[model samples]
Target chain A: MVNLAVKIKDLELKNPVMTASGTSGFGEELADFYDVDKLGAILLKGTTLRNRDGNPYPRMAETASGMLNAVGLQNKGIDYFIENIYPRIKDYNTPLIVNVNGSTIEEYIEVTQRVNELDKIPAIELNISCPNVKEGGMLFGTSCASAETVTREVRKAYSKTLIVKLSPNVTDIAEIARAVESEGADSVSLVNTFLGMAIDAEKRIPLLSTITGGLSGPAIKPIALRMVWQVSRAVKIPVIGMGGIMNATDAIEFFLAGATAIQVGTAIFRDPFTPLQIIDGLEDYLNRHQIDDICKLVGALKY
Target chain B: MPSNRIRMKKNVGEFTIVSNSALNNTNYHICLQSDIGLPDIAPGQFTNVDIPNNKDIFLRRPFSFFDVDYEKKTVSLLVKILGRGSKSLTELKVGSKLNLVYPLGRGFTIPDKNDKVLAVGGGSGVAPILQLAKTAGSSPGQMHIAIGARSAEDHISIADYLQFAQFYFTTEDGSLGEKGFVTDHPIFHDLTQYNRIYACGPLPMMKAIAARAKEAEIFCEVSLENLMACGFGVCLCCIEPTVKGNLCVCTDGPVFNIKDLKW
Candidate 1:
């Protein structure tokens, strides 16, 4: 059988297909439709040191190919996640990665410290690029200095794999990628949602309650691919690519572009079975190509 | 709960067109029979309608589970044809096979058997409120329903609701029961008469009702119509900010107690 196992630093995934953070809630909600063990990993919802009440009404807007969201990191704090959500997810076969968010460096440390205490969680995905929240979200991810600071502080408390999820809203994504790597980030995931807005011309009102939101879906796929390629080339750490990944072909494209693994986000809304389909498709591809291992495809780009 | 990823079995139900009539020159009332067994559906719950005519709007349109005939397994809807998406839904045949995602959002709270309930619906919002009245019809307590439309022609099926509720009608053009809005009618002048107030329809109308109910110390709940993509919670497109935080309207609610709402 073709080996689909992939290793990123200290962590190993059965396959390169993982669910993106925020899109997949703590790994419990998706269990109704599919087996959780079939996934390579599940990135939990974005969490902070303290519980946050996200933005006001109208947090989502629909676009042509995808949708926009201003969910504002509405999640139970890290403590609640450990006490309540973790106990449920820990029993699953897939690796659980907590996506951490904070408005300040100290908050990141506090969250990471709490998460480090958890026995089942294997990694902490520092969501330095969430566009919906007002404070620590896109703000920290936009600047290299802030990214470095948060990554460094979390690295101190957290001994597990630290993945810095970068944003595409910046001028140079490579610079931020390098900054997080320098600060001891174990891996990086590129292309969180892009800042976008839609308006109703006739009514003279914004379509979403927040007026503007983070755009995610097939519309942002090309941009996400380009960013992943750029960031993957810029850093030595493993790159987890995401944004608008809908099918098996898209997942394969991310692998060719140098991502060790790919995350399915917006596609889950359109078709719930997309992740399983991609996994099966990837297996077929490996067997067809006579490739004995799936890891051989990771960063297998030819210049 | 872990997110369910498998495609649930598509339940094919048939809805006979009880009465397909026009409303406000733009909207239509296309009621159908839900022959297949519909599980427990709540007030804020919605159904995903299969638009057979078009490929452009491949995704099903989510409408509140307006009303249910549990014994008959039938549900009804008030469709407002605003664009190509809704226009295609109105074209669906009465006996045609319709795919629906039923009981989606959390339904309104069931009133206590001894308490009085008031349901206010305006525009297309009257559908769910009518459904709520039918759901709470068996209660020993009294139920009142107030419906507001722009004109006489804007009104739809009232015969069904009349049997279950103290129905009140309002039309802005003085063509119906009363010559004013539902808020203008004497029935709503004193909100304290009702133990709980439920409203849906236009945003401004619901807001106004909520404000009045809050002042009269009555518990109020409104079903919000935020733009939604997936009726399930995955898209994160139907979130409403509240004191408790940003919650998915599709999951946490299309129904929210006024106290939790920021507005």
Candidate 2:
């Protein structure tokens, strides 16, 4: 039998498929459709230090083979999640990871400290790559120094597995990945949505409220794969890859490119069962290839 | 007091198009039959339909259940051709398969047997308003429906609902029942007779009705068509600012009581 299990720091995942942050809201929406615990992990919506109302109307724009969103991390803050949301989701068998975001370094540290107290949550995906927000999101991720600084500060406050989610808007994503690794990040997830924009030619108006939003879906798969390969080679920590992973074939490509695990993002908006379908597909693929362990596929890409 | 409504479990089902026909110049009525049996759906709850074989339109379009037949396991949507995505939906061949997430969001509150309701609709908003009226199960005198469009050609014939409701029409060009908006109709002059008011349409139109309903101190709700990505709570793209901060239009409601709204 092929083993689908993988590890990042002390956290052990049953499988390598996870729902991308900001796509599955606390795992409640997809739970109604199927059992969410079957997947490797559930990355809850991006939670901030304070409640954010997010961008104005028209926060999304659909493009060819993909979509753009400027949701701006609209969560009810860390306190509400602890008191209201955490209690309900704490009992899930799957590892529930929080995608933590902040506009300031102290906010990031404070949020991390609070989440460290939650026994059920095994990890937090540090989000410094959100393109929709004006202040600290992409600003910290685009530069190597700031990425290293924020990782260092948050690392001191939290006591569990920390996966830093990187932005693709940079010229050298591998350099940024190395910078986060130097600061004590247990793992790194690559290629958060690319910074892109869409326009309505006839109306002479930008489609998204923020003018430019983070783009995700099939259109981003190739670039995300390239980044995952580059970052995986650059860092010693396990790399969790995600960008437009719609099916098992798409996910297999990431594993071959050096991703220990992958997350399903925009595809969930299209089909809620995508992650489950992928998990089944992975098993079938391994059996067909005569591979005993799924980890054998990671970084197995030939020149 | 705020309404205590329990959130219902949503379903993702594959349905086949049973019929696709035009209701007006701009609107088309497409009926889809579910491969599985129908779930417990309410009046204002909507469905997110995946437009097949179209690369340009990547996201699924959301529409309220225009009509649903449990016996036939079919749900209908009244689609207005706003863009390439919607226009493509109207042209789908019969028997084509479409995947959908159904019974999403909170629907309108079904009125008590003694309550009389006035249902107002404009543009694509006509779909949910019709569903609300059909589900009300009230006599002709107990239910009133007001529909407004730009011109006579924009209005769809609701002769089918004549047995269930006292219908009223208002077109901007004065080609239909009355000249101005639905609020200008004769029914607006006597809203005290209605114990409940429900609207689903353009922002200005619903706000006008909500204002009138507030003056009469009647319980009123309106369904909002905010721009959304995932037709579930996760996306947070379709949020409407209410008394309780920001609430997702896809989950907390596509339908919400007027008192909860800042407007």
Candidate 3:
């Protein structure tokens, strides 16, 4: 039998497959399609200290093999999530990780501090890297100093497993990964959608109201994999790799490239059953390769 | 209005195309037959049709539920060539099997038997309105459909609707039944006579209808179209900011009442 278990700091996942934040909202939509509890984990939507209405309409546009979105963390505050959303999803067997975000260091710290008290939530994925929002998202991620400072301050408040998701917009993602490691992040996930824009040439208007939005899907896979490889080697903590992972073959490539666990983002939109399919395929791959443990496949690249 | 028993569930199935024909320069009608029996699909509900021929469009293109023959297990769609994804779909031949995620989003409320209703449509938005005319169980006192296009050549024949509704037509050029837009047509001017209004069209047209419906104190529900990835609520990109909060157009509604809408 093939074992697909993996760990990041003190947290242990049943497998190395998870759904990315914002892509899978509270893990409820697909309840009719599949049993979401079967997956490794579910990263909830990005929540702020207060309510966020998000951006204006025309916030999304389709591209070749990908899409662009500027849905600026449009969730009812953490309180609404706890009162309305939490009780519903709390009973699922898998861990529910809250994706905490804000416009300032204090907001991030405060949100995480509150989430740390929720027993059902095993981890908080600190999102100092959302590109769609106007302020304090990618601003903290692109710069090593700011990234380190935010991680350091938030570390003081949150006691649970804290995974800092990194942005690929940085010049040297490895440097930013190293900085977060120094500030005591349990694990790091990369790469959130790359900043991109599309314009209707004839109409002379931008596709998204935000003008520039975060691009996700297969179009950004190669870049995400390269960054994940670099950051994985640079940091001691596990690196959660994502970007354009459509199926199992794509995810296995991430494991070979050193993503201890991989998150499925844009692919979820295409098929709600993809994550479960990947988990089954991952086991099939292990059986074919005669690898008894899935963890052995992590960073399995030959020198 | 239907009772609270409305549990709008969706299904994923493969459908075989029986015919594909152009209705106008931008619009086409494709008929599909599902081998297994079909489910109960309401007007304003939609199907996410997969364009397998195009490598670029990895996502499915959503079209409002055009018509469905439950006995024959055949469903139809009114597709308009809008972008690369839809352009590829219109080029597909008959007998091509397309994957469909069906009966998605909530449908429009069925009106009461004694109510006078105005159903407005524009461009490719005529499909769902036609379905409502055919299937809205309540036999309303009177129903009128006003469909608009750019020119007389752009207007498709809707003779099938004659039995269910008294229909009107308009074109930008004075070649069809009327000269101006649907709102400029006579039915909209007599909005006070109608008890309810249902519309689906371009954003500007629906917004204008919503404004008039509000002024006339008529109940209004508009089916919205947005750039959608998942026809379900997983991806929040299809959000419409309403009075309640940010609601996903895919699940909470492709159909929403005007009072609940922020527009």
Candidate 4:
């Protein structure tokens, strides 16, 4: 049997497949589609200190190979996740990681502190790199000092495994990954949606509520793979790779390049059963390659 | 709430188009039939029609339940050619298969037996309102439907719903039954008679009806046509800020009482 298990510091994932935050809001939406526990881990939607109204309507626009969304982190705050969402998903066998976001360092710490109290939650993905939000999302992720400060502060209160999801809208992603890693970030996932936008020529207006949005789907997959490869080489910690990963073959590319784990986003919207299918496909791929343990596939790329 | 949901099952079902014909200058009537029997659909519920063979339009387009023939295993959509997806849906040939996420979102509240209901449909909004009036089982006198379009040629033939509702028509150019908007019709002069007001259409049209419904103190529900990608609740793209909170237009409702809406 090919073992699909992977480790992010103290936490152990059954496989290397996890759901990207914002795409999977809690575990209930896709609960009807498949057994969500079959996933390596569930990265819950980005939660903040207080409830956010998010951006205005017509928030999404479809483009070739991908779509743009300026959903603006519309969650019911950290308290709500602890009270309402945590109870419902706590029973699931898969690891539930809460992706925490905020406008400032304390706001980030507040969300991290609250999630740390939840016993079932094994990790917190510090979202210093959401491109859609106007303030404190990609703002924290764009710079080295801010990324380090947010990571260092949250790391102090939160003793569990910490994952900093990185933004791709930067000149040097490797530098930012190194910055967060220096601040005791257990691991880093790159790249979050690349900052992108679409416009309606006839209407002379931007397609999204926020003119620019994080572009995910097959459109960003190549760029994400490149960043993951770079960040994985730069940082000593495990690098979770995501971006435009649609199926099993695409996922194997991430493992080959150097990602310890991978998160399935945007594609899940099209097919909720993709994660399980990807997990199954990984097993088949490993068996086909005659690799007994999946770890052998990590960074196994030759030239 | 899951225990009491009207829809027993929801999925990506492959349905063959029995007919896809232009009903008017701007809209097309596409009827799809699935071999695997159709699910029970409530009014205001919609189908996310995947525009086949188009990589440009990656997301499925959300179309309200225009009509349904359960015994025939068919569901209908009133697609207005506004964007690439809707335009692509019109181009599909008969016998072409289209995948749809069926019975999506919360349908309208089934009105009381004795309640007098007025269903106002404007633009593509005519579909869901007509669906409700046709299958509502309300007596002819109790089911009042008013449909409005820019011009007479823009209105689709309503022969199918003739036996179901007491119909009214309006066009901006005055080529049809009336010369003004649906609200301008004499039928809406006295809103006190309508026990419930159900509307689905352009924002301005529904907002106008919402105001009148408020004045008359009649219970009103409006279906929103928010830009949606994923029909299921996965993507929070279709969120409508309501009294309860920021609820998904695809899940919490495509149908919501005027009271629950922030609009």
By TM-score, the best candidate is: 2
Query: How many clashes show up in model 4?
Result: 0
What lDDT does the true structure give each of the candidates?
0.80, 0.91, 0.88, 0.88
Model 1: per-residue Cα lDDT over A15-34, one tens digit each: 88898887777766667556
Model 4: per-residue Cα lDDT over A1-303, one tens digit each: 989999999989999999999888788887755567888999998999999988888788888899998889988899887888888889999999999999989999988888888899999999989888878999999999999999999999999999999999999999999999999999998888888889999999999878998788999988898998898899899999999999999999998889999999998877666788899999999999899887888888999
Position B162, candidate 1: lDDT: 76
What are the RMSDs of all candidates, in order? 4.2, 3.5, 3.3, 2.8
Residue-wise C-alpha lDDT for candidate 4, range B121-208, written one tens digit per residue: 9998998887787777776688899999999999988887777788999999999989998889999899888899999988898999
DockQ of 3: 0.45
Winning candidate number (DockQ): 2
- Quote the lDDT for A123 in model 2: 96
Best by lDDT: 2
Question: Per-residue alpha-carbon lDDT of model 3 for A1-303, expressed as tens digits?
Answer: 899999988778999999999988898876666677789999999999999999988778888889999889898899999889999999988989999999999899889888988999989899978998888998999999999999999999988899999999989999999999999999999999999999999999999999999999999999999998898899889999999999999999899899999999988888777898899999999999999998998999887
- lDDT-superior candidate, 3 or 4: 3
Per-prediction DockQ comes to: 0.28, 0.55, 0.45, 0.49
Candidate 1 residues B93-198, lDDT tens each?
6566665555577879977667798888988888888778777763324888888988988787677667678888899998998988788888887777789999
Worst 10 residues of 2 chain A by lDDT: A30-39
- Candidate 4 collision pairs: none
Summing lDDT over every window of 10 consecutive residues in candidate 3 chain A, give the lowest-scoring window.
Answer: A28-37
